[model samples]
Target: MQKKMIKKIRKRDTKGLDYVINNYSKKVYYLVDKIIGFYGREEVEECVSDVFYELWENIDQFDEKRGEFSSFIYMKTKYKALDYKRRLEKKEVHKTELEDDITNKITTEHIVLDKESSEEIIEIINNFKEPDKTYFYNRYFMYYKVDDIAVMYKTTRASVENRLYRCRLKIKEMLEGRK
Candidate 1:
């Protein structure tokens, strides 16, 4: 049934896709607004729109057996919103050097492959231990970025970068071993 739905979507089944978009767009908008706020409303709105485009483009990748599609969409929108927020916060820094510092600090070193690989990557992220895992989720998963994570958790951007580095390396190693 899920496969058939995915096939229908991939076949340019506008009605099927519309069913998804209509069912999910409100939730996406609410989450985006809640997380990104109006201070930088344009960026948030743009990112929310991007998330929907991504959802439509990648709809066939979804696997209902693993989890509910709505949860996946929620998480993706949340991350995109966070990324928007992170970019806006960095814009507040003003200095070119500071912007560079922020960019390097929160960079995501991971590459998402096909659905199976993405699922594996998510599983590895889920395996992280407290504080480190939560911090990581807040940073990358939420798109908090390094500087924002530092401010939110009362730490330094350098420290957050180090955490991200370690987390990335750890996940990389885990994924490599799984291959």
Candidate 2:
């Protein structure tokens, strides 16, 4: 059955994917729910969608010689669900400097300011060149995941994070100088 589904999937047959989804979605949902269930049904559903998409996109990397197809599905679903859970937790989890500073200041002091100050900060970030401008706006304003931002810039996650950190420090310094 796995061989048949694999062949159909490899051929880009939607029916093959549908078959896999029909067979595997419940199990995927069960696993994802067990991990990220507290976030509610919407998260569980999205994780299931992502798991299937990943399997379809990365089917070539799956080696039967390495493991069972069921195991592959299980592991993929598990990790994807965990990632979703982590993202959800991070959104509401803690109050770190990155979350506070350059967000909506520097170090322990949040540069509380009026509307003008906010505009000034926006202008400061906009003046940055190329990727820095893009990175800062996305990271600070759009709340994009660093990993997703890295993919957009064709760079590593560490690199994106490093750039964002530097941008934050620069902004912090600039804001301080204004005081």
**Runs with alpha carbons beyond 4 Å of true place in candidate 1:** 1-5, 95-179
**The 10-residue segment with the lowest total lDDT in model 2:** 106-115
Q: At residue 102, what lDDT does model 1 achieve? A: 57
User: What TM-score against the true fold does each predicted structure earn?
Assistant: 0.47, 0.53
C-alpha-based local distance difference test score of model 1: 0.73
Model 2: how far residue 9 lies from native, Å: 0.9
Expressed as tens digits, the lDDT of each residue in 7-116 for candidate 1 is: 77778776766676777788888899898776567866788789977877888677788898778789889888888888777777656646664554444443444235
lDDT of 2 by residue, 1-179 (tens): 87999888878887878998999888889999999999899989988999999989888878989999889989999999989988988876454535744453334125434324577677778888879999877876687877789999899988987887787677777887886
Each model's backbone clash number: 0, 1
Tell me how candidate 2 scores on lDDT.
0.81
